[model samples]
Target chain A: MIDWALVARTLPEYWVGLRVSLLLLFVSCATAFLVSIPLAMARVSRHAWLSWPVWAFTYVVRGTPLLVQLFMVYFGLAQFEVVRESAAWPMLRSAWFCAWLTFAINSTAYTTEIFAGALKNTPNGELEAARSLGLSATQVYRRILWPGALRRALPQYGNEVVMMMHATAIASTVTLVELTRVARDVYYNYLAPVEAFGVVATFYFALTYAMVGAFKLVEKRYLRHLAPRETGPAAGRPT
Target chain B: MLKKLALAAVALAAFMVQADAQQTRLRVGVEGNYPPFSQISPSGQISGFDIDIANAVCAELKMECQLVQQEFDGMIPALAARRFDIIVASLTITPARLERVDFSAPYYDVPSQFVARNGAFQSHSPDALRGKRIIVLRNSPRAAWLQQNYPQNELHLANRETDVYLELVAGRGDIAFGSSVVSTEQFLKRPEGAGYGRVGEPVRLQGGTGGVGIAVRKGDTETLAKVNQALAAIRSNGVYRQIMARYFDYDISPSN
Candidate 1:
């Protein structure tokens, strides 16, 4: 049922689309990672004043559909004359920039919640022990809280990154020409959904597996102390 | 379990046959977003030039017409899948589309034109638009034409024709190119579009046939012929002109 010949002939176009999808995935992932760190910290703050706005940001972003949010950024913002005449119009007008901003803000909300939850779950004994060792509040956070919480958040964050990769498909609606958009164009031109979407499915599957594999390696490195103690020498062998 | 599966398959085949036997109703597909061609009213009725033309064609063919709203991109696929008998979606007759479905004779034609802020350009020439951002509907003939002829211009593709105009108005694109009917009726007539005007003359691209027609499944010659006859009847009996006058003052029929 697979059209291997067509897949071969159209590989280059798919490759270009793959590059776009990956660019969106990596850039948005990096932006989310950086933004979520501070947002998560603020979310777990002792003061409500520090945390409420972040709460509201995550609440609204997580509550709405990503497509709606994308549209709001892409089309809704342009409805304002002030936005059209703003200094940022040059960047805001580019579909790629709008898509990146939407995805970054979206993933940051979800990732911030994940990191905050993990931070809250950090062992209280560790914080007490750090404090007892004469470590300042900033030193405790820098040396103990952030690292431990991050390690705990790794698996969930990995899943979030993969979800973000899939979510990038929606960027096509804004005409960014990512993987899903390329598949759609191919389907439109060739009238062969089987071959077109099949290729897309394969690419996504491989990328997801690669992401999962990388996360497994990172988890092994960072969460090793959390693993069950091995009794035999051979038990140390990599799975 | 095996017997039940076989029974289910047989039942599906019977239903398919029943569906095929019911030919009294002409199921028409329309994209309700394309203004002046087809649009959904606030009350949810599909009405526009394409819808009216489809209604006239159905009257001539003596079939009850049912309008099904579909996205423009999915209209042909929906027809091939038998979701509808014909598409009256202002779909341009193009060689790429002909490979998948058959189209009746042209019912109307509207040249593609570029719209930009007033005084953005004196002419729509490659030199004038060089290095300027241009927006067009994705997968459209205008997009293909821009990519081929004005490769120097920065091209942006928008999924919706409305978004192309939005990009232009927002200063993302220097010009927006799309159907003249849509540009004039949907955008140019709107208050927000007051600052914009059609730039240069309507662009007639080579191999970009602007003819809009009723689309049917490939090899469906009987329905194709009936649609063509109905189209010709409407045009000759002045029904076409009457309908055209309601929506547009100028002639939109194919130039040839």
Candidate 2:
């Protein structure tokens, strides 16, 4: 048995943390999506120099642990004079900004791989047909190539977004007040791991489950065209 | 045939003895992020003030020590679930904690203090908060103090002491509250705390000085007593002072 009052009291703390965690998730996901498209294009290019830079960037970001990357960007970069003098320092000076940057860059590596695979699966015939239509290179990418590739990458991209939602848990390490951070505050009251963590576990379970639900909603919307129009099994549920 | 049977019996006994030796190992849990206290070295080996003391504690108990790395917030939960036997990660002994588990004799005593980059640190009462916000480590005694004293001000709670320092520097809020032991390294660098200042005269002037002790599962009285004896031996043998020097400059001796 546990005290419901204590658990109720802890909910607000977790909510505050949850909000920050979601904020981090949104910021990182948007950045990673923007970065991945260009990096994937470069990776698919014939030019060695341009593609190789993207390769090295992806390799280094992937090779290191997220904790080390957070430390390096937050504490390590603060050491350099050039970064200090640059306009980027305004963003870097913030722990939240630095954490968001780390999450974005880290996800970019994984997302780049996903985008590259999707790009590879882009039909050669469609590409040729797109070319015959006299579509400009950028137009071809915008209209045909990107949409098709993105459809192939949706399932994977969805997973990344969900994982990022949970990965926001680590932001607490660098000083972001996410769900895990609030768990610690609850611990102060109960001092009992079982009592405090019981609430925390529920918060995380709710959060992770909510993320799962949201991802599914996104998946359904993206794949709705594939869904049977007539006599589909129980089409929509009321909120 | 008789000789062969006798030799087999002796071999079985030797194997049993070897198995018995391995079960006597002591498992230690640590966060491994709080450097100079508990951290993972570049070589992947766990080493720090707590590690050294844990080793000494194990030696005194006549058991081999095994170090396990866990997040600070999850350490106690893991222990409750029997993931490990003891926590030596500068865990402050508190009443709220005692309800769920038990603690050994105090090993290190350090006062909980606050630092502010803003002009002189201010507080109307233990409960009062004007315009200034105090950042505190999540899941620590400072959070306990805030929750008990100023429940409304939690909206301004900073997750970690480091975050508090950064927030103070960024002018997000005003003060950062933590223990002397945790802030000693930063304050000593400033000498007069020239850049930063301490808040209030210091509360919990007696038992509230932030004494850290090892936490063990409830009902593990034997282990608790053994740990207390080991801690006392470390103090008497001067090993405590040596371990204290690695992470702290001040003499934060626990009153026996």
- Per-candidate TM-scores read 0.88, 0.64
The runs of at least 3 residues in candidate 1 whose Cα sits more than 4 Å from the true structure, single-residue gaps closed, are A1-4, A232-239, B1-25
TM-score, cand. 2: 0.64
Over the stretch B76-144, how does candidate 1's per-residue lDDT look in tens digits?
A: 778988899899888778887898889998888888898998987999888888788888988778888
Please give the distance, in angstroms, between residue A115's alpha carbon in candidate 2 and its true position after superposition: 2.4
Q: Output the TM-score of candidate 1.
A: 0.88
Model 2 accuracy (lDDT, Cα): 0.76
Give per-model CA RMSD: 5.0, 7.9
Best by lDDT: 1
lDDT of 1 at A79: 79
DockQ, per model, reads 0.50, 0.23
| Candidate 2 TM-score on chain B | 0.77
Error of 1 at A120 (Å): 1.8
**lDDT score, residue A238, model 2?**
56
